[model samples]
Target: MAIDVGIIQDVETLLKNLNGYELLSYAICNEECGAETYEWLAGRVEGILVDEFRYLAKEKRKHAAELRKLFEELYPGMKPLEFNAPPLDTLPVCRELMKTKELENALAIAMLSETIGRDIYRKLQRMSGDEEVAELFKRLAEMKEAAYEKLLKLYEAMEK
Candidate 1:
């Protein structure tokens, strides 16, 4: 379950500086990118992996939509900050895993990404000043944890 230490450090450093709003904005972008990446992978892969990727793609979109809705409710007329996404690529362990043709590697990457996301959401929850925002992040972190559990089971089955 080892991912690249450098990538993890870079992601952690980048996330450390973001405030609650910025973290939410980046999370929206991250979810969108994750959906896109999973969709791309679905087309490239086959069998059970295809279904899993497609499911993950859908889940990512749902997460992005939820985040967007929260942003609207919390920030009102303020727009989300525009910037290049820094999740999957900047934390390039997933990108490197993407290069591997093995379907099992896909599950590994997905599991690892969910783990990273859970940590990010937990940090955001801790940083939130508003009760609602903190609750939202807590729920999101739980969702990520659930996703990781599902992926872990899938990975173990794939390994067998």
Candidate 2:
């Protein structure tokens, strides 16, 4: 129930220090996880909500592909550092959302996850020294923002 500001700060610090390859590696993993989560949610929901979740899953996969292409371009011939442990799975909210049967709760948690992602991309954009990398992050953040808006609309419509 209680959120630890300290852990959040520590994670931010860790992300800030990561090299381009490392950051992208984590990002790729995150996108893959998001797609999988969305697909899982789609299976649990009914009616139009299923389509919305599938759409989100497809978008996530697209983002992952774009990130992977960028990663390959930036670090030609070098493999992205393998992410042994994905931090997204460890997030309390993500864990809780996975177990939740309530559609409203799932939607809220998904929106929150997207918000966190957008914020992270914005932060990375600000911190990156490379112009190309920064621009890519900015674009990714914008895309995430769009996805968040769609999720917000869905949430509002469900509430009506």
The whole-model lDDT of each prediction reads: 0.79, 0.78
Q: What lDDT tens digits, residue by residue, belong to model 2 across residues 59-88? A: 889988998899889999987776655445
Q: Rate residue 18 of model 1 by lDDT.
A: 80
Residue 81, candidate 2: Cα error in Å is 1.5
Q: Which lDDT tens digits does candidate 1 get at residues 28-82?
A: 8988887888798788777898888899889889988998999999899998886
What global local distance difference test value does model 1 have? 0.79
lDDT at 19, model 2: 80
- List clash counts for every candidate, in order: 0, 0
TM-score of each: 0.86, 0.87
Worst 10 residues of 1 by lDDT: 86-95
Error of 2 at 159 (Å): 1.3
Candidate 2, lDDT over the whole model: 0.78
